[model samples]
Target: MSKVWMRTRGWVRRARPLVSLALVLAVLAACAPGPGSERADIKIGVQGPITGQWALEGLGFRNAVALLADEVNAQGGPLGDGRSIVLVEGDDRGDADEARRVAERLIAEGVIAVVGAYNSDATAASAPLYDEAGIIQITPSSTATDLTQHGYSRFFRVCYLDDRQGLFVASLMATELHVKRAALVHDGSLYARGLADWTQRYLQEQGIEVVYFGAVTPGQRDFTPVIQALDESGAEAVYFTAYWREAGLLVRQMREMGVDDVRFLAGDAVNNPEFAQIAGAEAAAGSLISTFPLPRDLQSPEAVAFSSAYEARYGEAPQSIYTLMAADGFRLLVDAMKETGSVDPADLAAHLHAIQDYPGISGPIEGYDEKGDRIGAGHVVYVVTEEGDFELFKP
Candidate 1:
């Protein structure tokens, strides 16, 4: 019995090694990519302030992207190679530090491209990470001029730069509005300061006197002191380079202080409906806003279809042009993917650089210049009607 037990133990040990080897082989076979195996979905990151102060804009962006993704997936996606596109949302909360963390998270999720970071500071903060990861980033609304100056090939923007917007506002004030004195107020944000600086430079070059150039701390509800100073400056026009919330509050405060004679003008950041809502219809009326073409303003068949589809899906019209701009960015990326027949970041970047006359929902994207800045980007001024609706300014 002892001899038989020893023989059985030796046999069992030898079979144990064979069984372990077989199990390892089976696991490898199951994990290996082959026929009948599921293919990984291509990931795209949508980073924005989904929960914080800029939630409206961020939600609009996410909704637009989601709508487009649904349409594409229904049609078999961009590749037509059996892999669907999956969107990963990263809520940066409009903060620079949070944007960096979001970027890292997106990179870890294996996103090949990113569609946002609405705030200029947030975009600037996260751009390096995307570039380092060889992920393509296309911002829909970040207009800070220095963003494209970073020499990051993978970074692109569908919107115009602050310089272009500044020049446009300066030209409008000098050539059309015929203003001699202008007061410049900014919220001290990176976007606001850069826009204020460029607007100041252009206004000075255009020979308009800058009566009062100052910075206002964001989130300060009472702008009484600034309104008083602005009224004392005797400026004909006031250009507020900041987001919609502060612009609305400032304008409302100005009207409350009986500073009605001064023209209130805001940059593209104030294009949201909340601007007028916060300022009240009477106070918001007649204010000028420099912005890209709004969704309601687009007349093209494609634009009309997009607007209808967006409204049908979301149950309301897109509030800001940034939403449409974000959709355009997604379209451009998909176009590049289709043109190259490859999801390789380098290939997509190259295709984007070479793209010409690509029709976008916003307008004709004349393609990116050497610095990835959109060429032939222009801005138009909109005037708030008595009903608090934006209309293209005729004069």
Candidate 2:
């Protein structure tokens, strides 16, 4: 070997162990708090329904975030800070009470941030708990109009909310579907109620007759009452603002009852394979849904890699592309942690406040405004095919 190459190889051999020892010493120095080193590991918390009715969505969030945590770890964690990421996951079981409890527990666990509570009610219920404890909250699927209202300092979302989704559905019905009349059905949950109310108001303002606005209890397997009401009201479309579990059952019952002519428009909650599972191919077929960016339509190589990894791990396609948004939520929290260089919610909230056009795996992200709403105007809609594939539709 050349003399220069020999010298370089000798230098590498001499420096490797010293560098490793220096890194270990620096980690120890981080724990002692000095001006010389950074933290060893930062704990990031994730809260969502790991069990109960929406476990599929909750599990999807968990799986996606886990994948991201691994990726973050592989990159040496938070850049420029010399800190590694350690993810602590909590299961809320899709219950409001459980969400609050999990929020409190995650805060007490010394976590810097939390990922989600998939439903609006759960997010709203747990926001104050996280805010008081200085834990930043980021969710992908909670879309109630007032989610970020009342100045929940740490609350943020990764996708469009009810007001925008409601308008998107209304416009799709009027301009695209050419439907002049409609009915609304919800699961009596806050998320469903908000979307349903907004859809009715927008349709009425647009000169469309909203003949029925109604609710159903969650876990109800029968929909004869609602379907009969819609049929009598002469609605051209029945807008469903409920989760897939209930939406699927309702649609199946409606079809069985011969109410097949009316177009079925659904909310983001129904944008998953579970809907097809519950209602079967024909019952879920021809149904339209509003949701986050489509996974199949993602243009980024990183996004494609995530989708492939998700499919490989789960033995099926991702339930919804919103999983990517949820993953982005956790990523933003980690980014915010790096920006503030501390886990304090107030500092991180300030960092979040200044974020503009953060290019994430899902798409562009804008932090909350004065009203705590994300400043953006893009949410997609998709239609379910009879063969159980989701067809991307322009929102």
Candidate 3:
């Protein structure tokens, strides 16, 4: 099914009473105290691919938002700013168009800022709407180099960008893992292609030859040819710059083809519990993947408390350590509102830009200049081990 069709059908099947309830709530929501409806607390919108291949990312973000909302409310709500804070949640279903539409709707609803749209393509599509509306966006997982290019002005990211992450992986392959020969395989999608190109250039610069650069489609059933090509090339490592679905197939196919020596490595897009679930525990057992650090020694008191509260409230463990980053992003906007003493979009943006070394849950996120690149080149790298799952590989 098409992305639109599937999204439409999914909503339609649940729309009957739910849609009516939504409409009624919208009408009744006029009395609610929010920046959009009132001059009080701001409405922070959160969006992500909640039900698609990258659902884990969205689920983690949603849980963090909910946790933060509760904590903020307990502290007398959304910085008060003379009013109450409200969270307006939306789903983008992993489609760029859906992400764009949802962002527009949130802006129309008067949100001061937005939290996510996990992948780069979705973030790239949704950011302009927030920019045109003069609302800020702090994505926990959008890593495309161009998402903030042209200074979307209103756009910000919690994670490192393409160059830092891609090059970090290249260095890991060259110096740490002893990987001399590699194949850069991607999903043929925007995020995959960008990361692949960056990693390829960096790998070559490090004197490591890329034996093959392969392309595969999302949801492609079998990866026999792709795996066969890598096996034939005798590459020691296969670097997959795609999401989990294709990564699962490629890893399994490599194992089935009797290519056990070829180590499979992936980027953050494929780093999740679901990868092991779909890719099978044994096939995924010895794989190597890169992701954010564990942050077990968080310096911020709020971050430490939030971690405990999250585990207690959710029961299940949180994926996406970026979970805490999303909450901190929301808090930063509210803090900006308080610091500026006005909800004027420009004033809020100014405050965010002036921020320095603000400790957040995922770590510290420093605001950017017109270029939107992180000032500090401090991206930590990881490796998936048979025993440790994914442990910090490079600092």
Task: Report RMSD (Å) for each prediction in the order shown.
Answer: 9.5, 8.5, 7.9
Error of 2 at 335 (Å): 2.4
Candidate 2 residue-wise lDDT at 319: 56
Model 3 Cα lDDT, one tens digit per residue, 328-364: 7777776787677676677777777788877777777
| Runs of candidate 2 exceeding 4 Å displacement | 1-40, 79-82, 309-317
Worst 10 residues of 1 by lDDT: 1-10
Clashing pairs in 2: none
State each candidate's clash count: 0, 0, 3
Clashes of 1: 0
Top model by lDDT, which number? 1
lDDT of 1: 0.88
Cα-based lDDT for every prediction: 0.88, 0.78, 0.75
Candidate 2, residue 128: the lDDT equals: 89
Candidate 1 local lDDT, residue 201: 99
> Which of the two, 2 or 3, has more lDDT?
2
Each prediction's TM-score against the native?
0.92, 0.86, 0.85
Off by over 4 Å in 1: 1-38
Report the Cα lDDT for residue 119, model 2. 89
Off by over 4 Å in 3: 1-41, 295-300
